[model samples]
Target: MSAAPPEEEEELALPRRPPPCHAVCSSRAFATLYSLVTYALVPAGVVALIEVRYAYLLLFVAQLLLAVGAVEWSWLAFRIRQRLLLAVSLHEDGPPQPQEPTEDAPDSSEHPPPPSSDVNQSEEQTEAAAARRAHALEDQPLRREDPRESYARLMAEAMRAKSFAIAPLADWLFCGQWYLAAFVLASLGAAASVALGYAVESSVFGSANPAAGWRMMVGASVEAAFVSIFCSSLAPSGADSVVLVVYQACVLVASMNAYLKLHVDVIASDSQVDPLFIILAGAIVIIVFRVVTSKVVMQSLLLVLCDVLGLVCIVSPLIAFADLIDQPMGHSFRNQFALFVLVVVATDVGDCLAKELQRHWPQVFQWCRHPLLKSEATTKDVEALAISLACGAIMIVVVRLGSGVSAFNAVEVIVLLCAMALGQWCRLWMAHVRQMAKVTTSAFYLSEGSRAGGVLDRMAVFLVAIIVYYPYIKQKYFSSS
Candidate 1:
């Protein structure tokens, strides 16, 4: 009979290998775990009830994709484990070690090593050794390609990250039932804001005001439309650029809208009715601001100012209606806004911690007597964990306190100051990291400056301009004092 084909012969060979010793094959368990935890528990059907905003549904879908990516991430870890296990098993079954050369050959220095006579023999031995090594190396690369390896790596990374978990958490939050939850909360906040805005205009300010509550709503719609259109146009450039531009625009428009609405409230109470005049004036101001500033420093300063202006938007109104700060509508709105700030702050802190841990942990553990895998209770590691926990806790507490404070009060100013100070401070200290972070963060989710030289050039000019304009502006608009 003809010899059997190699594939059939191999398949017919008796199975020599034992079953995997570990229940999960150790390598694949975490991948299975991640899939279950992230997809089944988090980012599932539950989040929808919490947020309840239609816009959040889009966010939720994005988050679901992220979670799915994470689930996929665990594959690396599984592959690594499998490779390690194979290595261990192979090592256990490998041939016995050969004996060392007896008495060795004559000492190399004394005999000058047996030269050309042994050259052919030595070459043959070297070639044989090379063949053996090459054979050993053959399966390693193939083993490395295992999908589980990626999942394992991602798990290890996720476990270590602290600062950058928001995007991850957002994925988790968006994918599951909690996505609904986030939607609901956002919806409720939006609805509450709209209702309060209307009630304030119609009941408190009177329907006869120059810009009715309805008109304010229309203005807000226009502003939002402008932001959406601009952002969409930029989207084709790249996700990061799109996110950054859109986020900045949203912040700017929201701030400007709030500022304009507050001003409209004041004007409606007493001023003239000339829609074209206000529009023309606004357009002129925009042109001047855009035209006069060409330098990077000026542009960055303007960008920050616009961001700060968003806070100013909500702040101005509360300050104007200080008596209403304690009222239910005002207090509720303030709490909600404060919560948003807290969330952003929390995200920043988490991302920073995760990044720091990622960069420094290897060096920090290098000097230990035993590696972390063996040492369960290293003081240094404990200290690091403790510090991280403490910081996270303090942030949570501070955010809670912020939420309780009335908007436009001392607490509110302090919070706003904190936001500005932290933003600038981070911008200064983590300039490079921030650039990297902006791109990385935007890659998942979607969301600069410098200035002049000398002390006098920077401060004196700045002071003179501020002093000259501050009084005039305050006297014109904020002159109750």
Candidate 2:
């Protein structure tokens, strides 16, 4: 085996520097702590919230944040919806303007200069060149954007961001109708989750197969629906008989969708039309119907019953679409899975910060002089070990919270750490060994870098957890219904 070129090591050692916002805020250790703390807001962790005393306190904190952020959320969502509507309208208006002629193309003219009789076509080539230059000159006004436009774009982006990260809890606290909340939640919450995962991917693994942000958004929206349903199904309430049926139905419906996704081909369409917005539209229709029906001189209990049934109906089709899209659809109930997702975002952000700190300022970790830490390939190897450790810890915590501590649970955590660590070590070790020999023409590295991307991390953690906890999961959640 031949050694990889020096460029491979250089790439690993020097990633693109993060944005200034990240450097000052999310990169800090405090941000990692904040990430874990936000998990309390994830209503999907009801299994823990109901059982753990600490979680009860966290519930209050989560509630407080959500309630306070609603005003901000309302404003942000309104702006985003306006943008979405306008953008969609313009997109449907007409075919996009034709691209400017390139230098290689024929001259653009109503009447072309007769194809030059010369066989070499020198005159034709010159005319084409002149025409291309003219086209470029004409494009300058549209291409050269104004500074104010850039500022407005940035501000719009900032607003879109706030809509996703903030806002939730005290479902009744928001000013909008139920469907309005659902629409914004579906759009911003689902889109935010997708965006966070994408944000980490580039630094960790730049590859030939570029990630598709739109497909990811569609999928994340699907997962959002399922996760929310899972969390909502676990909501605690003191109810007798028939009311228990509502909660029971919620759990059954959720698990049913999970199975359908795993086993059935459910989604009828795979075109570019985003089913998420369509699902939200469906919810809106249902909500509007319920609202209009309430105006009649009917009993309040009947009205409440209709509202609950309408809510259930809305989620049913959303889950069904999720099964077919091979994507996650969440939102409508952002509190459920929204904050739990920060675990990935935080870990990725923190991991990059650590590497950045080590590469640029090794003195920060100089206090720890362990033998293993002394490797020449310090930056990349350490990053791999960090991923293995981080993945192991998150799995342990999440699994334990979902299913209390057990003998098998201990073994499961150990096995996962062993698998992840060995995988990371073997990959890095082989890359290092390969770098010594210069065996191949191509650059040899385990992946683009050792730092983990949040999207990959979440996928890896969940995949491992499913395999390790399949039996327990089947017995506890699936069979419970």
**Candidate topping lDDT:** 2
- On the 0 to 100 scale, the lDDT of residue 85 in model 2 is 46
Which candidate has the top score in TM-score?
2
- The residue-by-residue lDDT of candidate 2 on 264-337, one tens digit each, is 32312342334344444444554455455546433223334433443343233323322322222222112222
**TM-score of each model, in listed order:** 0.24, 0.26
| Local lDDT at 110 for model 1 | 40
The whole-model C-alpha lDDT of candidate 2 against the native structure comes to 0.38
Write the residue-wise lDDT of candidate 1 on 221-336 in tens digits: 34333333322222211222222233333333333343344533533324433333433343344335434543544433433343233223222222222212112132234343
| TM-score computed on alpha carbons, candidate 2 | 0.26
Error of 2 at 181 (Å): 18
**Candidate 2, 399: how far from true, in Å?**
12
